[model samples]
Target: MASGQVKSAAFVLLLLNLLLYFIVTVMAVWAVNHAIVRSRKTASVLTIPARIFPIYFPVGNMATGFLVIFSLIAGIVGMATSATGYLNVTDGKIQNLHAAAASSLVTLFLTFLAMGLACKEINIGWIDANLRTLEVLVIFVSATQLFCAGAIHARVSEVATILNIYGSGRV
Candidate 1:
C-alpha cells in the first residue's frame, strides 16, 4: 500500500477512536450525574452509603479506566502514524507526520495530567470540586485535540492529491 493510503487509513482509525471516546465520555458523565442525583434524593444517610457503593464505584471506575485507556491508545496510534509519515519522506507527508506526533504528545500530556488530578486522594475542602474542574478541562482539551487531529488528516489527504499530481508530470 502507498504511504498516502496508510496515512489516510490511520487518520480514519483515529477519527473512529475519537468518536468512541466521545461516546464513552458522554455515557460516563451521564452515569456520574445520575448517581449524584440519586445521592441527593435518598433519605437515609446510612442507606445512601449502600446505594452509592453499588452505583458510584463501578461507574466511576469504568469511566476512569476508559478515559485512561482511550487516551493512551490515541497517543500510541498518533505516534505510529507520525513515524510512518516520516519514513515516507515526502514533503507533504512530513507535515502530516509532524502534526500527528505533536498532537499525540499533547494528548498524552493532558491525559497524564488528568489522571494525576483524578487519582489524588487529598481533599482540602474545595479539592474535590477542583478535581472535578480538572476533569472538565481534560474533556474540553480532548475534544479540541480530536478536532485538530481530524483537520490534520484532511490536510494530509489534500497533500496526497497534490503529490500525486506532481508525480504524474502534470503542471
Candidate 2:
C-alpha cells in the first residue's frame, strides 16, 4: 500500500484500539472493584473453598482471577500502545515507528494472553453478564490489535525498504 494509505490505516486502527482499550480498562476496573468489595463483604461468612482462592469472584469460575488481571494489564498496555502509535504515525519518523511497533507487539501479546484466559473462563461457564461483556471485548480487542500491530509492522517494513532503495529519506 502507499505510504499515505498505510499511515491512514494505522491512524484509524490506533484510534479504534484506543477507544476499545479505554472501555476495557473501565470495565475491568469495575469488575475488579466489585469482586474485591463483594469478597470482603462475604469474608466473614466465607466457606473453606472460598478462602483457598487467591481472589474470589462471586460469578465466574477459577479462571476469572487470571482473566481479569490479564485483561487489566492488556487494557493498560493497549492504551499506551495507541498513544505511541499515534505519535509515530503522525511524526512519520522511522525511529518512532520502531518504538510503536515494539509497543504494539507487546500489547498484542498481552491481549492474546487475556483472550486465552477469557476463552478458558467461558468454557468453564458460570460467568455473569458483565464478565461476558469483558470477555467479548477482550476477544474483539485481540483481533483488532493484531491488525493494528500488523499495520505498524507493514509501515516499518515499507520505510525500511525505502531507506534501502535510496540510502536515505531524500532521493
Candidate 3:
C-alpha cells in the first residue's frame, strides 16, 4: 500500500487501541480491587476461601491472578504505544516513528502474554463475566496491535526506501 494509506490505517488502529486499552485498564483495576475485597473476611463466620499471597481471585481458577496482572500491564503499555504511534504518524518523523514502532512491538508482546493467560483461564473454566469480557478484549487487542505494528514497520521501510537511507549509514 501507499504511504498515505498506511499512515491513515495506523492512525485509526492506534485510536481504536487507545480506547480499548483504557477500558481494559479500568476493568483490571476493578478486578484487582474486587479480588482483594472478596478475599477479606466479611462476616464472623468467614465463608470465603483462604487468601493467598499476592492475590487469590475467588471467581476463577489459579490462572486468574496472572491473567489480571498481565492484562493490567499490557493495557498501560498499549495506551502509551497508541499515543506514541498517533504522534509519530501525525508528525511523520523517522525517529518518532522508530520509537512508536518499538513501543508497539513491546505492547504486542505483552498483549500476547495476556492473551495466553486468558486462554488458559478460559480453559480452566470458572471465570466470571467480567473476566470473559477481558479475555475477549485482550484477544481482539492483540490482533489490532499486530496490524498497527505491521503498518508502522511498513511505513518505516517505505520512508527509508524513498529517502535512500541504507543500513550502511551512507545516506
Top candidate on lDDT is 2
Higher TM-score: candidate 1 or 3?
3
Which pairs of residues collide in model 2? none
Per-residue lDDT value at 107 in model 2: 93
Task: Pick the TM-score winner.
Answer: 2
Q: What are the per-residue Cα lDDT tens digits for candidate 3 across 5-90?
A: 98888989999999999999999999989887876553224444443345567667889889999999999989988987898878
TM-score of each: 0.38, 0.94, 0.89
Tens digits of lDDT, candidate 2, 50-164: 7777867766788998898889999998998898789887887788889999999989999999999999999999888999999999999999999999999999999889999
TM value for model 2: 0.94
How many angstroms is residue 95 displaced in model 2 relative to the true structure, after the best TM-score fit? 1.0
Global Cα lDDT for candidate 3: 0.85
lDDT of each prediction vs. the true structure? 0.48, 0.90, 0.85
Residue 161 shift from truth in candidate 3, angstroms: 0.7
RMSD to the hidden true structure, all candidates: 11.3, 1.6, 3.4
Q: What is the lDDT of residue 100 in candidate 2?
A: 94
lDDT at residue 52 of model 2 (Cα atoms): 70
Candidate numbers sorted by TM-score from highest down: 2, 3, 1
Where does candidate 1 stray beyond 4 Å? 42-96, 108-171
lDDT of 1 by residue, 27-65 (tens): 445545654566545524445455545433222333443
Instruction: Report clashes for each candidate as comma-separated counts.
Output: 0, 0, 0
